[model samples]
Target: MPGYGAPQNNGYGNYGNTGQGNGYGASQPYGYPSPAQPAITVGDGLSWAWSRITDNPVVLLVGFGLWTVLTGIGVEASYTVNGVEHSYGLGIPGGNIISLAAILIGPIALAHVGILTSSGRKASFRDVFTFPNFLQAFLAILLSRLAILIGTIFLIIPGIILGYLFSFVAYAAVERNLGVTAAMRYSMRLLSDNVGLLLPFALIGFLLYVAGAITVIGWIITGPLVALMTTYAYVRVQGRDVARYPSQG
Candidate 1:
């Protein structure tokens, strides 16, 4: 929290009063001041994410469970398609597509759960499918990934840089209901001003994910925790009081 700029009144006031009463209460307007805390370091981000996960095990776990089921189905479909392609010596399209769709959509749902949980609301598994701007969220995520993939093709560093720069696209799309292009632009703008703090946060998150992948079950915790952490960063960057939530302790 050290490097976050002075906490601006992003109109959300405290974390607890996210304007959930009105549909627009959950997020602040985009033009508010940047976060009051310093840019978040890796340790801070991890700690904050872990705390949220621990504090709201039921919410994160239920969300993760639903996500796991969908992912498992996608993996099964991919495997089945690969088998058919191998047997017939014919190309089968959309095998990887299934997996890609799962990857893109799963986070949007989980991020929604994280947003609700972090705001001190009780979230159910059904909340996973409740994104109001589904079309925009899907398109925004797809475009962001496409951009990153294109960047990686030319140079590894630019791709990695773009990945971090646009990391918040999904959050903005879901929470703020921004259009696909606007979400990407908003994420880039926020990161451009705070990459120094957020880059390490992203790196640490990557390391945690890798460690979790070593034991697939570990992701049940790490995955949602990382999502929650990212949500926390988004809130902080938007100048909300992340520490106001009991989970932040």
Candidate 2:
């Protein structure tokens, strides 16, 4: 595996294979890159993610569908409150607690598939269930939201900024197996230099989701696309290379 002073290898250059396993296993250097690391634009990340989806359309659909069903079961189970028809589940300030299962598990599912896709391997249904560092991931999600909530208390803008800053916590925790604080800190530093690009990337992804939600069937595509785009960005920003295009079998 490549490290700090390692020479570039195909774009994964300085950073090597995340680890040896089905998922992005263990610590594979989520540290700072050389000062001159190339900046991956939002377009680059989206395009790479799109190519990956296009290449594995059927499998992605199956995988994401499976994920939806698995997570949806938990979400739906808590919908009824005192026999009332609560379609949206237990509500909170932003979203509902029932929906939190999806929010928490979505990224981990994507990270598993994305890591395989980026590694030039075929994505599979099992990837959705193959959670790496799930406990750390769960803790990171809760802690990051708590921090964001605190920031939100201060003012809306600070909350949004913290949201953007800590956006990659799940990736760091699951992919690198970092602890809660370490994962939060890693995510902050990862994007500290890329805020200008992060805002627009996030906005476009949100718009895609909203548009997809309106169409209903569109979520089948846009949902994974946006998640994979984030995965691409996270890998690239770490000074690693992603399979920009799909590999031929």
Candidate 3:
């Protein structure tokens, strides 16, 4: 696309979110094991799964869009690991340079998009990558990646687990204003409370990622789709009745 140093987030600028905090029972940052109790049934696997699915209807809808973006980006790159295995390439127009960069920058942009969902804001992938905010996102992603790297030292499975477990790191950075360690703790608490949902949702995320590969130009639409689904999941997990940001489309 644009040059290496091109800015990422100038597309949508601010989403005009005045919610800040304390509006609509959002004051308490840590509301795990919520006392208010939502209408959706949290009991029974079938009931719980259905509740989660329906509560976060945006997940399926948004996921479709995100998968396409991820797939398109993946397709643009060349998938190959050098003989030593230390080297990998995604084979996009930018070649290895952008590929390695995406490995680091992807999560940052993804986090911005995820946060936008939290506010119930609609944003393009281009919007998510907008300017200075991306720097914060990049930092948050780098911290999480470090944790995954630690897991890799132990074993491949451990690394995967670490990545999955810490998936919510973005939540802290984007929402609760938490640093890496705090964000990880926040994720752990949420995950512990809803292990079943977390596992399945993560699986769904992976499946969408894989599924998006069905087409080459899929990302233009899939990218937004994936972001939408993720935000839907977050809203559901937080026991939200309506999406954080109502859908404009």
Listed in order, each prediction's TM-score against the native is 0.73, 0.71, 0.57
**How accurate locally is residue 235 in candidate 1, as Cα lDDT from 0 to 100?**
72
List candidate 1 stretches off by more than 4 Å: 1-41, 72-95, 243-249
Which scores better on TM-score, 1 or 3?
A: 1
As for lDDT, the candidate ahead, 1 or 3, is: 1
Q: Which digits, one per residue and each the tens of the lDDT, describe model 3 over residues 1-249? A: 011121223333334322433121222223333245344322322343333334444543354344334433443423456643343335556444544566566555565555554444444545444433345446767777887898898787878887777776664445544555655666666666777776776676666556655664544444444444554455467554323224342
Q: Report how far residue 140 has shifted in candidate 3, in Å.
A: 3.1
Candidate 3 residue 149 Cα shift, in angstroms, is: 3.8
lDDT values, one for every candidate:
0.67, 0.67, 0.49
Summarize candidate 2's per-residue lDDT along 141-183 as a digit string, tens digits.
8888888999999888889888888888877766666677877
User: After TM-score superposition, what is the CA distance of residue 3 in candidate 1 from its true location, in Å?
Assistant: 24
Query: lDDT per residue, candidate 1, 162-194, as tens digits?
Result: 999888888777676677888888889888898
